[model samples]
Target: MQLDATDLKILQQLQADGRISNQELADKVFLSPSSCLRRVRMLEEAGIIHHYCAVIDAAAVGLEVDAFVQVTMRRDVEQWHENFSQALQQWPEVIGSYIITGDANYLLRVRARNLKHYSTFVLERLYKTTGVLDIRSNIVLQTLKDTQQIATSLLVAE
Candidate 1:
């Protein structure tokens, strides 16, 4: 969809607070509640707005450490990629995975209770997963910034 200023405004507002009522959204965008509702629905149908989700704190649930693991495979075969993706998808501990641009074939973000838990993940779970030839990791010392929102300034530029 061709997102104009109004669409971008709606998206920016929604990005800040998805739980915002249509009535409040209408006020922000200078649209009627019904119009805001219609626009949001249209954005969803057009795939401009993909989905909404809650961001949870890992430390609150016995997850004390965050890890970034870089995995390299022997080969970039389709079956190998599929097998790895499927395996990671089934493991809830593997919070996020990306086929990224770098020396590593895949990048994974994992949260564990502690170093011992991470050892189990690497030695037991990760080693057991198929097609993993080499793995490297950098433990997150501190999180300076984290966000789920895409910058409106970037996305709205035409």
Candidate 2:
């Protein structure tokens, strides 16, 4: 779908506040309520606006340890990759997982209560997963920036 400047503005407003009322959103984007609603519905139908969710704080919820784990696989097989992907979905500690072009096959963002809990997950669960050859982890000491918002202004430029 071809998104215009108005669509970009609407997206930016939504990204800032997903729960903003249709009337408020329409005012912000300088459109009628019905038009704004129609545009938003179109964006949703196009899968541009995937889903609305509340962002939670990990530390406030007793999750103190955040680690970036690099996993190397024993075999470069499609089935092994599929199995590993399925296994990740079952592990709640893993918040994010990605297949990247690097020494590791997968990179996982894990959240735990503490270092001990993180270690336990790595030792018991991650290591035991089939085709897992090696694992490296870097625990985050401080989080400088973390956000789900995408730059809609860039979309306008495109």
Candidate 3:
């Protein structure tokens, strides 16, 4: 959907605070509450605003380790891709998985309690998977930046 200045403003505010009341959002964007609510509903219906979620601290929830895993497949077949993707979706430790370019066929972002837990995930789950040929993992030491918000400035031209 084509987004005008108001829509962009609404998106920006919602990204910053999804829990903001409709009246508050309207006041911020200089729109009537009814108009603002209508626009938001439109955005949601058009699939622009996919969903709202809370950002929780992984460490606070007993998940201390974050790792990026590069996976290579033995064969570049449709079945292999499907099988791997299905397996990934079922694995709770795997938070994010991407079919990337370059050397690796797939990249996975995983979170675990500790090193031993990560090792078990690799050895028992990933290694035993039929289509998985090789796996390389790099554990994260310190996270500098992590966000789900999109940069609206780039999309909205001045």
Candidate 4:
């Protein structure tokens, strides 16, 4: 899946504004509308463009409390890791989770209406999860930045 300068420019523009029209995109990338559409389709077929989504404000939706929970496991085993990941994906409140190179086995992002709601989640579910040796939660004071974008500037260098 090698991308030319035009492809890179198209991707960069789309990443900046996904809603940009095909005509606008083609003009920006210096391609015909049909050619641009074909390239976009090719990117999708190559799995380079995974998915499109709208970013929503958690606070605006009434889930005001943003939290990070660090869980230390009894041990890291393939079976335990697989089971944990499977169980994790089923829990909707567990917005995002990561396996990190740190003391904690996994870091989790959780959203709730408030501290009381978060506490209930911690006690009932997070505490009850199997193979969890310890847990520490940090409530967010404020969010400075959060984005799913990757830098497109590296494409040319690569």
Candidate 5:
């Protein structure tokens, strides 16, 4: 809905720390706790605040490798798209998937334990999926920056 300066502030604070208590969030936004909670609830109701989750370290949790996979569909059919999308939803290795432009029809962010595991996933699972024409993967050498935070600059004019 209509987000004012205070709403933007609330969003920025929450983006930084989703675990912040309602009272703490209110203090940061300089609003009463009840008022701040109401705004948060409203944001959630309006779909601006989707869900809060913990961000875990992939490497620490046995997912040491990050891969960007480009998938090309065999046919430009509606059924093919639907089937592939559903398949991706069930696959745990895929953290993010986008129907993109350019040569590749879909781009997937995947995590694996190592290169051998990634190879097995590619050869056994992704390649065997229906309507998969070609699959290209780019392994991340070094991750400079990775965060789920939404840019607040878009909501504010400089």
Candidate 6:
């Protein structure tokens, strides 16, 4: 859908606070409650607004270790890429995974309770996975910024 300035304003408000009431959202966006609801529904139907989720703090839930794992696959193994992708879905420790242009075939963001827990995952699970050639891991020391919000201001330019 082609979004106007009003649509952009609505998106900006929603991105900042997903839980905002329709009445409050309407007030902020200068639309009536029904109009705001209709526009939001349209956005959802268009797949612009994918879904809502709560961002949980990993440390608060006893997850302290965060590591970026670079995995290189054995090129000779049949269906190695597909098998590795499937394996990632089964491992809860792997919070995020991506195929990237680099020395590694895949990059994985893994979270664990501690160093021992992280080590166990690397040794028992990741190492044992078939077609895995080389594994490199860099533990995150600190997180400076973490956000899922998109800059609606930039989108308005398009």
Q: Look at candidate 6 and give me any clashing residue pairs.
A: none
RMSD versus native structure for model 1:
1.7
Residue pairs that clash (backbone atoms under 3 angstroms), model 4: none
Clash number for candidate 4? 0
Least accurate stretch of 10 residues (summed lDDT) in model 5? Answer: 149-158
* TM-score per model over all chains: 0.92, 0.96, 0.96, 0.91, 0.95, 0.95
Residues 35-89, candidate 5: write the lDDT tens digits.
Answer: 9999999999999999999999999999988999999998956699999999889
Model 3 C-alpha lDDT per residue in residues 1-158, reported as the tens digit of each score? 89888998999999999999999999999999999999999999999999999988999999999999999998955599888888888899999999999888999999999999999999999988878888999999999999898888877766
Alpha-carbon runs more than 4 Å astray in model 2 = 76-78
Clashing pairs in 2: none
Provide the lowest-lDDT 10-residue window in model 2: 149-158
lDDT of each: 0.89, 0.94, 0.93, 0.87, 0.93, 0.94
Model 6, global lDDT: 0.94
Which stretches of candidate 3 lie above 4 Å from their native place? 76-78
**Candidate 6 residues 1-158, lDDT tens each?**
89988888988898889999999999999999999999999999999999998889999999999999999999999999999999989999999999989899999999999999999999999999999999999999999987888888778663
Candidate 2 global CA lDDT score: 0.94
Q: lDDT (0-100) at residue 44 of candidate 1?
A: 99
lDDT of 4 by residue, 33-116 (tens): 999999999998999899887888899999989999998887755577777788788777899999998899999999999889
TM-score of 2: 0.96
Which portions of model 4 miss their true places by more than 4 Å? 76-78
- Put down candidate 1 lDDT per residue, 6-88, tens digits, no spaces: 89999999999988999999999999999889999999999989999877888887899899999988685558888998888
How many clashes would you count in candidate 1? 0
